[model samples]
Target: MDDQHLHDHRRLGRELGLFDTDPLMGAGLPYWLPDGAVVRHQLEEYVRELECSAGYRHVYSPVLGKRELYEISGHWAHYGDDMFPPMRLGGGGEEVVLRPSLCPHHALIYRSRSHSYRELPLRIAELGGMYRSELSGALGGLTRVRAIQLNDAHIFCTLDQAVEEARAALALIARAYADLGIRASRHRLSLPGDGAKYVADPALWRRATALLREVLDGSGIAYDAVEGEAAFYGPKIDVQIVDPAGREATLSTVQIDFHQPERFDLNYIGPDGAKHRPVMVHRSVVGSVERAVAQLVEQHGGAFPAWLAPVQLAVLPVSEAQERQAHDLAERARARGLRAEVAAEGSLGARIRAARLVPYQVVIGEREADAGLVAVRLRDGRRVDPLPSAELLHRVTARVGARGTELWADA
Candidate 1:
């Protein structure tokens, strides 16, 4: 990429102190700075809240798993090329590798105990860390990183429950995109075709693919069915979205799998008093935290909305006399849950000028400090002067606390 063609995500990431990848540390391994961590934390919290309300039970699993685990899930055969090399312990242990995906471990959790049909669908979710060994030439900023943290979840349910589960996953994905003010362009139904990559179980593939189509067709959403893009295990629905610069990318997906459960021998007790295999649905709302953060940086051009900004408010004192007032005001804003701070060690004008992505800048002078008030400066350079401190805090906090999107105004 040339200097003129450079992605804003790479430029703004350093300018805003969001994230960085070190070639010395390793290619594609990014370190999130303090500002970046705050954004990532908010993303995780938002998704966790959504999953909780949707009846998903969160869990933790090992970062490294026995080679046999992937052997059963078929990753060793189908996806081994992308994974890191195996490591063996000195105590005569079997081969293990950093997990390339969390589904295999989650599958083992389900297999650990038997369930009744009453537990028709079990949803497992996690903000999981995973690794893959990609060619150095292919690695770029956060978008194509080797190390990633996933907003991943897996659902175990009966064959009859796949359609409802798939539809529900789509609903969550749609709601999330809408809340972020981004469009989910289209649903792409990825299928098996005349390729050696796809798993060959004609009867299972037919059944699974048909059920997924039923859900998409019933939902009335426009979609394109593409062949040779499905995973080896099964077919899936890939949601396509365009970035700020008109570049398209696959941001999220819901897959129907008939292979993993069968390979792992996972079963649930049926209403007929017999054991039956459960199906698996793999889904992610935001595929990788790093990539999502990059998208947000570019989407807003580093000017994040009030709710998600790392530094929501900056308090600037006109001189040493008003320094105490500045700090007190900052504390007051913090008590109200705003990420506020007192801007110290700079001229009043310099401090305000340095407020790049800060949504609100409060400038305190002699008259305002005496009247127990603040002067609010917005990103657009408009000033709201001489407001009571309490009132100032209320307006800013309301917009942030409500998570309001565009068409938002502060008091």
Candidate 2:
């Protein structure tokens, strides 16, 4: 692997002050600066919009769960090693663990309600923070961290609806990747492994694998089959994307589980009046927010799209005499819902240079301010013709809503 690209990203991240890691505070934990937080908030908003449009209801669950909860979910036996050590409170008896996933909590929520066949498919989504203990050496900027914000969701559906739900999940992931400018190569279908490591039911594994393959084929998506990658309880499909460094990362995944419902005794009254277990599908469009942000930064070389740019426009006054106008123009831009700011304490050239370093779309100037307009400049250093304040507002607002790259285009 060439160190050039890797070093480039690390230098850019530090120079932009997006995030920082301090050994004293412990490794694998990143402290995000205000600029970094802005990027995250934009990502959260984007994911929320996607989930809402796909008919998933937003939900939240606690970060820590009791030890018994994990035992019942089979996480204690299967994923205990990946989890942070339990905290023993009140001396010794009770133990709590930071949640590694949201599936168990969502399952408990489903069990809390009694549902009929009419409500067979229930989808819940969350943008929640999750934690896992990682070796210090494994920690990197935003890509590999101990604490991460996950864009997670769970769907509980009848066997008859499982395939459709899976298709829907795939569609959601594809659309999200397109929006983020990520290109999908091929899907990876993870099936149950060998007899020793998997449930001793060959018939069931074969049936599930066949079902997943059928679904993938019918959806017209090319995929490769891989054994031993599925969760102990079920088969899964992972969307792989190649990063700037040519490494494949599982950007999103959808898993179908027929076993978890049985483990948790989750059932719904069927159309025929008998109680039956509903298949559970766990998915995430952008698997981990930290990794997603890192990918976005590298993909665009740190020049984010307008909607995701921490500061969409930077207002620069040519001299101190133009400060009031710069502030006024910034206020107007902000009122129009664009993230705009005035650079009041730097040389005009220095201010514009600094603004270009970040992912802002335009740099306003004194000449346009005198005409009640703002001069615009693209991040790539191209100058846009001056536009009236109202016109600029409308243009910026439109680009933001559409999440278009043309937002930085010359007027």
Candidate 3:
């Protein structure tokens, strides 16, 4: 992990004005700047589109939950030490606390309505914010923090549909990783061991673990079985990728649980006209938005693709004579759903350098402006001849629309 290819996202985030944590506002909460928020917005919007198309219904949940809620979910008894200290209602009553995960609350939603076998794979998704109490020394940039938001969803399905749901989840993860241009090199079947941390049901635990392994094997995803990594509630398949520094990271996962449905008393009507418990599958396409963005910035060395770039195109005018033309071009790009900006006054080298980290750069001069052409620079340090305005726009739109990782140039 200590290679030049591996750089600290904290430093890169700072340099890019992405986010910051202030002591007065607390140690682990980050305030996202505009530049960072734009990137996050793009990531989340893309996630919503993907999940929605996959039949997940996005929903909103409250940040705080009753103490009894976690008790039923087993979090109060099994995971209380990691949670923030509980607070009493109206000075002294039922205790409430910030939610550390979205599963329990999501479980309550499934229990809210009666369901049928036909509606078996009902998935509810949320990019929910959660909180945990961490010691001061443990808090670092976005990667390790107290406050976090994750792409969380719980699937309610019959036992017969478990493997299929798991397959669907793996497909989603595969597509997401492919689009990000990163390889998910590890598929880990995380199972329970040592009756200490997980629910100690020997028979139930073994069955759940076997089902997850079957799904992974059936998909032909090579995985290593890891002991004692399953969630307190269930077994999971963790998709891990090699980060820039050669360290493995688990940011996407699919979990199957026979526990939550039973604990929450969730049931669905089966074809035999009998009520049966629905299995719960929890999955996240991308785990934590902030941490993923941090990973991405470091992965690409802070030069984001045109589609994901906070500012996709940087337009620079050589002199005051061409300033209006630059702004006009920027507006046109913006109208076409691109993030574009006009460069501030600076020397040619300075202006180009300022926009170096961005995907595309356009320099406007008197003759080129009159010719409806803009000189552009590619990420490979290749400065191409002035191109027709229509041609440049077409190329930029194609790259952004495809959300490609590289800004291609003719070598």
Tell me the tens digit of each residue's lDDT in model 1 across 325-372. 999989999999899988977777788888956888988899989988
Expressed as tens digits, the lDDT of each residue in 193-276 for candidate 3 is 785568777777888888888898899888899988888877899888665557677889999898888899989999998999
Clashes of each: 0, 0, 0
* lDDT, model 2, position 76: 79
Give candidate 3's error at residue 58 in angstroms: 0.6
Poorest lDDT segment (10 consecutive residues) of candidate 3: 1-10
Question: Relative to the true structure, how large is the alpha-carbon lDDT of every model?
Answer: 0.85, 0.79, 0.85
lDDT of 1: 0.85
TM-score, cand. 1: 0.92
Query: Which regions in candidate 1 have their CA more than 4 angstroms from the true location?
Result: 1-7, 91-93, 244-246, 344-349, 380-385, 406-411
Query: Cα lDDT of model 2 overall?
Result: 0.79
For model 1, what is the alpha-carbon lDDT of residue 139?
79
Quickly count the clashes in candidate 3: 0
- Using TM-score, give the best candidate's number: 3
Candidate 2 residue spans exceeding 4 A from truth: 1-9, 194-197, 344-346, 357-367, 408-411
Pairwise TM-score winner, candidates 1 and 3: 3
TM-score for candidate 2, residues paired by index = 0.91
